[model samples]
Target: MNFTDNLAIQLKAAGFSATTDQLSQFTTYYEMLIETNKYLNLTAITDPHEVAVKHFVDSLTALDDKDLIFKEGAKLLDLGTGAGFPGIPLAIMRPDLEIVLSDSL
Candidate 1:
C-alpha cells in the first residue's frame, strides 16, 4: 500500500482518523525530510515504515487529549523538536493550532 494507505491504517488502529489530503501532506513532508537528510543529519530513521511509525505516529501520541490541544487557537511549543518531530506532524494534523517548533542546534 501507499503511504496514505499505510498511514491511514496505522492512525485508525490508534483510534485516529486522517483524510486523504492530510495523508498526502504527510507524504510530501516525508519526501522533503528524506531529501533534506541527504546532506544534514536530520534523522537516523530513514526507512519509510520506521518514519511513519516512529516519527509521524509517535509524534502524534502527544495529542492524546485532543479536546485540550485541538482548540481553535491553541498555542503549542515543541521544544527540542529534532528534525521537526511532533511539531511537523502536529501542524499537519491541526492546522488551526499555533505551533512553534524549536531546537538548540
Candidate 2:
C-alpha cells in the first residue's frame, strides 16, 4: 500500500476522517520533500512509512482537540519553525486557524 493509503488507514484507526484533498496534500507534501531533499537537508524522514508515522501522524495527533484548535479567530505562532513540524500540518488540517510560521535562516 502507498503512503496515502497507509495514512488513511492509520487516521481511520485513530478515529479521524482524512478527506481526499488532505490525502492529496499529504502526498504532494511528501513528494516535494523528497524532491527538495536532493539539494537541501530539510527532513531526516526519507522513508514513506517513517514520514507518515513520524511526521504526518505526529502532526495529526495534535488535532485530537478540534474544538480548541479551531476557535473563532485563533492566532498561532510557530517560532523557529524549521520546515514547520506541527505548524504546516496544523494549517493544512485546520485552515480556519491563523498561523504565522516564523523562522531564522
Candidate 3:
C-alpha cells in the first residue's frame, strides 16, 4: 500500500478517521515533507510506514480527548512542532480549531 493507504490504516488502528479532503491534504503534506527533506532535512524518519506510525499517527493520538482538551473552535499553539507535527495533524482533523505550529529552526 501507498502512503495514503498506510496512513488511513494507521489512523483507523488509532481509532480515528479522516475525510477524503483531509487524507488528500495529508498526502500532499507527506509529499511536501519528502520533497523538502531532499534539501532541508525536515525529518529523520523518512520511511512511509514509519512516518505514518511515528509522525502522523503519533501526532493524531492527542485526539483521544474529544471532550476535555479540544474545545470547539479552540485556538492552540504547538510549540516546538518540528515539521508541523501535532499542529498540522490536529488542524487537518479539527478544522474548527485554530492551530499554530512553531519550531526553533
Kindly list the per-residue Cα lDDT of model 3 for residues 28-77, writing each as its tens digit: 99999999999997899999999888988898777896665888988899
- Per-residue lDDT of candidate 1, residues 1-105 (tens digit): 776678788888877788888999999999999999999999999888888898999888977865655667789999998899899998998888899999998
Give the runs in model 2 whose Cα sits over 4 Å from its true position: 65-69
Better of 1 and 3 by TM-score: 3
The lDDT per prediction is 0.87, 0.81, 0.89
Deviation (Å) of 101 in candidate 1: 0.9
Give the runs in model 1 whose Cα sits over 4 Å from its true position.
66-70
Worst 10 residues of 3 by lDDT: 60-69
Best candidate (score: lDDT): 3
Q: Where does candidate 1 have its weakest 10-residue lDDT segment?
A: 62-71
Ranking by TM-score: 3, 1, 2
- The segments of candidate 3 whose C-alpha lies over 4 angstroms from its true place after superposition are 66-68
Error of 1 at 59 (Å): 0.8
After TM-score superposition, the amount by which residue 34's alpha carbon in candidate 1 deviates from its true location, in angstroms, is: 0.8
Q: Against the correct fold, how does model 3 do in TM-score?
A: 0.92
Give the Å shift of residue 45 in candidate 2.
1.2
